[model samples]
Target chain A: MQAGGLPDTNQVSTDPLRNEVPVTALGEASVETPTRAQALLRKIEPYLYLLPALLLVGGLLLYSVAHTLAISFTDWDLITPPRFVGLQNYIDAVRDPTFTRSFTNTLVWTGGSLLLPVGGGLLLAVVLERIPGQRVLKTLIYLPAILSTTVVAAIWSYVYTNNGVLNETLRWAGLDALARPWLVFAPTNTLAMIVASSWRALGPSMVLFLVGLQTIPPELIEAAKIDGAGERILFWRIKLPLLRPITAVVVIMSVIGSFMTFDLVWVMTQGGPGRSSETLAVTMYRQAFIMWRMGYAGAVAVILSAIVIVFSISYLRATLKRSAL
Target chain B: MKRYSNAFWPLLVALLLVPALLMGGSIAAQDDPVVIDWANDAAWHEAGQDAVGEASLGVTGIGVNTVIFTSTDTYQAAVRGALPTDDAFPLFDWWFGYRMKDLVDAGLLADVTDIWQGHIDKGEYPASMMGSFGFDGRAYGLPKMINYWVVFYNKHVFAENGLEVPTTWDELMAVAEALKSNGVTPFGLDVVGCRWCSFIWFEEMMVRVDPALYQSVMSGETAYNDPQVVAIMEQWRDLLDAGYFSQPGDFSDNWEAPFVNGDFGMYLIGDWWTGSLERAGFVAGEDYGVFVMPGITEAGNRSLIIEGRPLLIAANSPQLDVALEFADYFMSVEAQTVWAETSDINSPNLLAPEETRPGHLVDLANAVANGEYELYTRYWEATPPQIVEQVVDLLGQFVLDPAALQTVLDGAEQIAQDYWASAGGE
Candidate 1:
């Protein structure tokens, strides 16, 4: 009957005298009993219900992804006969300077995004949980999460433009000399895009952490306080450790999202100012769609998937180890 | 697993039923019409759609369904993705050469050569525009519209700044310097979002310097980083450094914005840009005038980069005969006239009557007829796709750092050499 526990059987029974109802009638109830063949049919009925959906989704995933992998090994251009090229696509990708740049950009993007959003979200969640009007603050902070990424990118593109709102505001506040083409400049473009990415990413992490924060019992914190813990000590020693699992989830999600950062770059820069802003995903898209080199693109995609899988596995393993400790 | 069974069944059943219902609904919806899917570029303004709607009223025997995509990049991607499937649009506008070759080689494009030959024998469209649709002496598409780059300058801006249309390199430099000194940006070049814009400048310069050299580079006859190319890069860099461009880093800014605002003097863009400019509330011949790009060589010849949008029929389309008939009708003078008047696009059919021409289109026709133009296919359409990307990216980088001219040129040369070797080029 408690919120966290399973439902009580006592609540289902109206009276103790109802237990005298015939056992044979209960067995014969349409919801309960069947013959041997019917029981076997009943046992497999759920599987029958699920068969079409399983086949549809499973067949699609297998055909598309497996077909893509097979195409990656050939010299298919989405048009011509797919000549078997072995590992040429993979080899070419490694040798490509643009591909190398894209790879490095994705790494920086993934690492930087994970740190900012997950860390900031945790910090904000801990602080905001105790603040007055926490619900209002939570709603305000989480609003951007519900907006489409296209809308977010459009707003951020204007802010990042040369004479845009960001620069205009900076200039008015006596930062005139610091203003430059934010998204056009080489080393700064990636950083600028990452900032925009973090803004959109912050909301989801904050919400996740808020939910995680609520699950940590008030009694634990009270006990920590009674044990003579200061605010800083309580946070670092108690709250932080308790929020570790959620933080791991947030970080892994952020990493994957950052690695696949395409829309923001596509809408804003289109991988421009000379390929400085291209991620591996953008490169894959260009090779696949723009150039119609499907095989090469497939190779890039396979490599990207491998990287994501590795990162996710290592993250899970580390999270598990930390939780065990 | 048994403990979770209660939670799992309802969720599973709901998920399973939703798709089944949707599939049934779609199947039921398809029984009423002969759907012909026609895909068009985003650049085709609403007027084109209106014209199509009007035109389709005349063909009541056929039921047509048009899916218009606004983004050229997305449209191309969709067409490529849909090729292996039965669901690709029955007809679509595709760029010539590379796009046509790829589609034809894949056996995805219907051979519309017979239709084209029939049109040609009837003297419907120009033979030159047929160059775009033809690959290895076979036609796969019908050229719907033709476009070529011309130097479009603001006459008011030029007159106010006491500058004439430059016909030579020296005059262009002088005009640019004068404009810069007077606090006006000389040109509006959108080099930020598209590397293709920068390539236009590169090719324009290359053609002016030596058309043969440009063709050699495009056809892999010469290295992309050759001395001639380096010179062209140096010239481009010099122009940028001299303040010929309005805003170098503002690549996201539409070229027409600065031009329309009367802050920039000129825009080197294709004829198709006139539609966008008109949409932005600018008039041609009154506010702006078209001129030939200046000559870098002694010949004083003008070469315009031609890009054609060809309407192609899908090979596997069940309605192939209907599609060809529609295509033949689409390329006729009557249809082209409708296209030119309504969409404000230049028709490849030379017979498009002058009476039906839009204001700027009339001017374009005049310019082409006066022997002031020669059609040169866009480098993107002419060159290998990888080479196009490499060249464009290098040009964009050069715009940022003029000092990186040699390095960019060298990089392009390396890519060109590699491409040539791989492609078995002579």
Candidate 2:
């Protein structure tokens, strides 16, 4: 009934079709609703059509977000009803060394996840564009994308195992010392997982870059060639700038994927060699599900969600500006 | 409009009958069988399906749905999520010990005491196993199998190297030094990234130190930083530093390759590997053999670690009636013989005579029957799940680098203290 500050809906004509033709009322041409009930119906008709859908989507989303935020302030195992302990969960998370390690690892994961996939994808897209067996190369590289995360993790971990493919290759080449257990130690452990994930991620990113590459007109490249511009100059000055928008999207997706990563890391190392390879997502899952500390887990989830939102907003703003240009 | 109304009546009738038709169809389907869902790890999917099929053979109007997950961790994760809901499977497989008790306390498990008591009355299972699956005199699960840890050595290799099954620490060490001197890896300690199995030698070393201490430690009565625990670490460090172990990889089934080729000599692993060793083409009691791990001294204590897998029924399942029927059949001697043959496991069913089981399995069964060794539950499932998860990593790390023993042990102590404190120092 309050309708906020919306314009005078009380004047709405229930007989919308009939009211478009002006009726002479009290010496002036004006529209009129014969009844208050009819006017009210007209005012609320659009809302009636929209209410079901809005309640379905908006209500669900609002409840989920509010519930998550509320849980972040409490201490609950998944089995027990949450008990209010405002700010304690957050404070504990801040002081926990494991959380700190997980955060740092998450940053490392995000950085690697973005740079390698995006860079490799762009390079592959350009190189394959001119190559003869382009279809085959792209198909082979992209095939991993169709495989499930479980399959990819399984295959890659086998490759990284002590006597697995990589080590065997090194041994066959007589470089025995070069083949350390790629997944058993830190820095190397995280890097190895990144390589595996990048393999699976590179395909879709390349497809996006390929689409962006198609948007560049051939005449520009021909013109650059006529001006004695080399391939490096052509890419650095013209093509690279043109690809920024697609690149931003790929980078953002990769970063988001890194922040939300759980499957491959879990399959490969289970975030161990003593939590050395744990990203925030893995740590959060271990706390909530494995350790049964749902509230603390919720706090970590909020922190992760905040990081993702901030990055997404900044990237989206820049992308929008770039598109506008 | 007149013609359309004529058509509309038939359509309306059909639409109205849809619900009735569905109800009738579901009723017809229900007449086919009562469905019992069995959730377990995919590693045993075929075995489980086979066992269920064999068990269901004389029973009528029953069908079992086997839902197998790829791994234990993922399966446990899914089970935990599903436990609080009515949509959970009626029957699932899990490790028994403190974990079972935890669920029993949480009121998540069904009271399977009737089936358990029936099995005992039939003398199908031993009292000890029933004890494992129960707390406060109410059983929650049925024991599937127990895997006894023993030192499996290549009989041919041992014969060729002029070595005997060592029965004391001195002889074991001398044999290991001899194997190393001969350029053969003495023990296959390969557990690259896998958990739970990495603690085999750790358990061996602990029980060797003092079985009572090991039991107390598992119960949280003894701390990880205890001097006896420190002694276990020092001894483990000495053995590891001697370069007596094989090149440790993620050796799941690949262990066969080195064992057959004689590059790997002995492995103090669970009886679960009996099947794998057979698969590796080793003739039991001829080409390969099992020996109890030697005691620490010439005259001292010795113990046997018994690891069992249990099948539980979810309390919230609507199909619990059918599931209980299935579980009863699963625990029978008739079912267990087929189960033992099909899955190549030593089922703990006492009614399944020793003569019917595999030779290597019969050996341990006889030992248990003779009361030749003291029994202790496996440390992996005997203690708290969280503590096991934390310490297994540290134990695995110690295998990689023995110098970190003290640091790892101290860290384990801190984790234990924190966990137990938050658990109200249980």
Candidate 3:
């Protein structure tokens, strides 16, 4: 069998208890060949073990996706029965100013995710590798990641309010001009939410990178050092290249996560100040739940899913090709 | 691919079918008591469920099961999602007017015209109230509770400032000026937490300025940026510029301590707010007093903005007769009184006893009943919900920054135009 795949159960085991067919029982009973029904049952036993998970994934996950796709081609408000409208909902989405704004904001959020969470996380991981009291520093830096997203959003909202701690501190330091309500304005509102999201995401990203750094062979670094490689050169030429697999995982997660961000934005600004801070997910939620435009929301969901799927496929293909070397 | 054993497909299907069959259990047996599931969003009234259930059960053979949702948004979503299926609640609370009209138009709500007419004939409910819950000459709901929009003020602060409740447009402005001069914020504006609160002043002032214009705007006959509406916006701007309003506060059902502690001299809100104040330990008529807002024009005098929710019966409910019987009982004065007392809110029934309610609410109810004031639906319920939701956000922005008045007004007009045009009303 391939590495990490299921074990080769056809092989005999030295331990009798561990063997699927007991050697003693076979010898003592002078076992005859199994009947067709018994052999068939034996062949299907492994599949029986997999049935529950298959059903759950098929019944709920696949059904929901298919249902959403079907609904996207219709016009439906919760109050009225759905009417097939071809590509009308998607057409409406394309023409909508709010949808355009949300799409742009979503791109901005993704960029922010790349810069703050992924970049900062790597920087933190590298710094921790050379720092004293590394364990304490690592724990402290990773603390916020363990919090629930809603709690993080709520805490950050309090910090961003007009009279909240951030503004109060600014006022105390005579930076009164900077003390505007951080969550009530457009780009600033979106940025503030991104910062909150990054704070929560940073810990996990840092931890992953730390694990990646540790997995690097110390002997390779020693050889590079012996060949006169300095700290920066060692990291650039050797350590960074070795961390590609973990980096791929982190980047993929951050990309999909930034695309699907909703709860933080919803809790903090509700995409408000007149839909100024809305991302695509926020727009989808508002359309479906608040406006009761289920079909339009389904279209938004489908578009979002298509984008994420495309990104995932292209990213995995590139990363896997590079990693295979 | 190698074909699976013959038994595999059937086994998989049966395993999947087991859960589906369990979830879609057989309908209740004939001997079971008809349980009427009543979905509501009023978390505060959860304690009163047993009393309400007992009262309704005595009148109808059905038992009541009140399911209280966390918030209005969730409740609305849940009710709409469940209405088409057998899992639908037999009854639920919903907003009146345009909000209710959506459900009525979809043929989801049971017709209650006969029950309404019966109550109207008995003089238990006013005939005029029927229009709010009716469409195409058919009533689809019964009023669960009603609240009149009134200005509640701190009596001690008013007395300290030597001001009485103003009765005219000029007098009200003068009172506000006096309160401001005395170093008290003239109004308590709650817009942050309770999103719907942002529409209160807009609705209140619009009706006060010109009730006809307000009605026209709501009906899509007049643009929100019409010159008349601009004039009202200017008046509101002047108040903001004069610093007559306090910083916006979060106004949940439990957050009445700010107003009770004299943070603002007056608060213009629905009479239902009295419950919050009372819960915060403010005694009605002694600690505070209520007054109907005076008109900006002569047309505004004695005009009150009213808001309420109605209890609707699902058309496809299995216990249709029992649900109807309970609804009929709900319309009776005794049932209304019990519900009002238990919930601590005003009942829609005109003949319900008022002794149990606060003195201020009782007086307002009397004034409304005696035709001392003309009633206009609250803006939230008066206009299409889709427009209202977007417009309220604009209104909130305007509240935070009065300089955005023109932008806010334009945005509102656009939203209104879009909704009206799409609905084929314009």
Shift in Å, residue A222, candidate 3: 2.9
Question: What is the DockQ of the complex in model 2?
Answer: 0.22
**lDDT of each residue in B242-352, candidate 3, tens digit only:** 898876422222247667777678988888888787778898889999988888778888678988788899987776778888888878887787887888877878888
Question: What does TM-score give for chain A of every model?
Answer: 0.86, 0.84, 0.88
The iRMS of model 3 comes to 5.0
The TM-score obtained by model 3 is 0.88
DockQ-sorted candidate list, best first: 1, 3, 2
lDDT of 2 at A180: 84
Clashing pairs in 1: A79-B106, B192-B251
The regions of model 3 sitting more than 4 angstroms off are: A1-34, B1-30, B154-164, B178-184, B190-194, B247-263, B278-287
> Which of the numbered candidates is closest to the native, going by highest TM-score?
3
> Lowest summed lDDT over 10 consecutive residues: which window, candidate 3 chain B?
B246-255
Q: Candidate 1: where is the Cα deviation over 4 Å?
A: A1-34, A60-62, A132-137, B1-35, B43-64, B70-74, B81-88, B117-124, B167-169, B251-253, B298-300
Candidate 3 pairs with clashing backbones: none
Candidate 3 local lDDT, residue A75? 84
- lDDT by residue for model 1 over A1-325, one digit each (tens)? 3474733333222222232343334444432433343456557868877988899988998778898899899887655568899999999999998899999999889877877788878878888988899889888888888878778877887787677788889999999998888877666888888888788778789989998988889999999999999999988898888988887888888888888889888877778778888999999988887777889999999999899999899989988898998
Q: Candidates' DockQ values?
A: 0.32, 0.22, 0.28
Better of 1 and 2 by lDDT: 2
* Native-referenced Cα lDDT, model 2: 0.80
Task: Decide which is better by lDDT, 1 or 3.
Answer: 3
Q: Name the top DockQ candidate.
A: 1
Lowest lDDT 10-mer window, candidate 2 chain A? A21-30
